[model samples]
Target: MGLSWQQGPLGAKAVGQFLTPEPFPERLLFVEPLRRRMRVRLDGQWVADSEDVVLLHEPGRYPVAYFPREDVTGLDEESRTTNHRDLGATAWFTVLEKKHAAWQHTDLPDHAKVLEGRVAFAWRAMDAFYEEDDRIVGHAADPYHRNDIRRTSRHLVVRDGTRTIANTKRPLVLYESGFAPRWYVPRADIDTAALKHVEGETFCPYKGLASYYDIGERKRAAWSYPQAWPEVAAISGWVSFEPDVVDVFLDGRKLVLEPGQGVVSHGIDRGLDPDELQERK
Candidate 1:
């Protein structure tokens, strides 16, 4: 969700934000009862399964699913950690000898009473997470986050310094929540010879896996959704450039990287030296 943390029902009661003086700015923290069957797997074994799950949506954060403790199994208490969250102290747990595999709120504020005794698993620590039969990718889907693709006739062009990499008259513009507009150019219009397929890939919950293209020395200058999720199938095989890495022009005007356009590198790429981009090649 694009909402701020203080805009939701428990916003005012959250420990960190609540301490601020009134008139408190509206933040958001949406907690909704999920009726669908949810399951968590670790090392190819089901660790938690529940029909009654709660989904928490915090601004700028991915949705997290909380399952009732009774439905979960095979967890051993590891240690207790003082929670800075409004939801009391936290008790950490390990699954199948995995370290810090999960945690639950030991105590909760009255406003967050619904989350009492519910456990939230670390998605990255677990082998897989499922809503029903299909595996959920990336982070949990944000119910409030949405993506829209619109066909546009505006001329678009991408360049790596003086080398023109792509040019197109028909472009697809994707409008996604909490992100700036991304223009996708037709593959036929791109200089295919200049694109070098990169080794790494990224995933999106709304969209499917993305393949990157290296423009000479500039790594990941452009990317394409080879097999996009059904919701955003229109952008499948269409190339989109990273505005911060390359020059993009629309309708004869040069485009500038707007605020929030930077992609936060995560996983193994996080905290590495900037020069590591060359090693990834």
Candidate 2:
């Protein structure tokens, strides 16, 4: 079992469905103060630095950090546009000729008054975003999303139709917020001959770059973190099967994909760049 959506200050469902209005039936927006020192870099220069930052949590979107206008530098007004659904008037700015690098609310609604005089940098446009010295990857980290990896002796098996792909008694169970527990099997216990390496990859901030494997025409049916982050080193070189793509069993009991585990496309991939890939090391 994973963490429930409503268990945290902000619901995990809201962050997962960031662009949908269904999760926010009340049409409410949340703004709260961020105590950490936040910084933004553009064009090889620090464009913004502030200890007093506010975070806006819009429905179906990751939290965005807004810095005090006075702390930002080298911004030129690019254009003015109406906000989405008339929330307010928005002003766009360019940082060092990077068009639409930042934006701010010029006309605030009663609910979004806290955003006044604050500017938010586009995560994809900026060279880097930081919470103090360490760089932040992907979108802003969701306060509600949590991940835990537990080592278990429970017998687990992965199969594709009648072919057994992996069988292990030592499995690592990864429990992430709003998702089902993913069982990771050790490489030694898996039949490597049954897996074919696939091209392209995906990155996870909490983990690292995930290398995919094909199981007899099942494209990307399994994934492994070859070089995982220090925090989740237990899953390094261990493979986890996509329950929806193949059959997974625990002690001979078949497992099914949970309701919220369906894959949904998101825009965070836009933030991935050569620099960001190189930063993984």
Put down candidate 1 lDDT per residue, 186-253, tens digits, no spaces: 88999999889998876455676678988898888889988687889899899999877888999888
Error of 1 at 142 (Å): 1.4
- What does candidate 2's lDDT look like per residue over 41-100, in tens digits? 876899999999987766545678899999999899985565855357898998999988
TM-score for all models, in order of appearance = 0.82, 0.86
lDDT of each: 0.75, 0.77
Candidate 2's C-alpha runs over 4 A off are 1-24, 263-281
Give model 2's clash tally: 4
In model 2, which residue pairs have backbone atoms overlapping below 3 Å? 17-60, 18-60, 18-61, 19-60
Residue 28 lDDT in candidate 2:
50
Steric clashes per prediction = 9, 4
lDDT of 1 at 217: 88
Q: What is the overall TM-score of model 1 with all chains considered together? A: 0.82
What are the candidates' C-alpha RMSDs? 6.7, 4.5
lDDT, model 1, position 10: 39
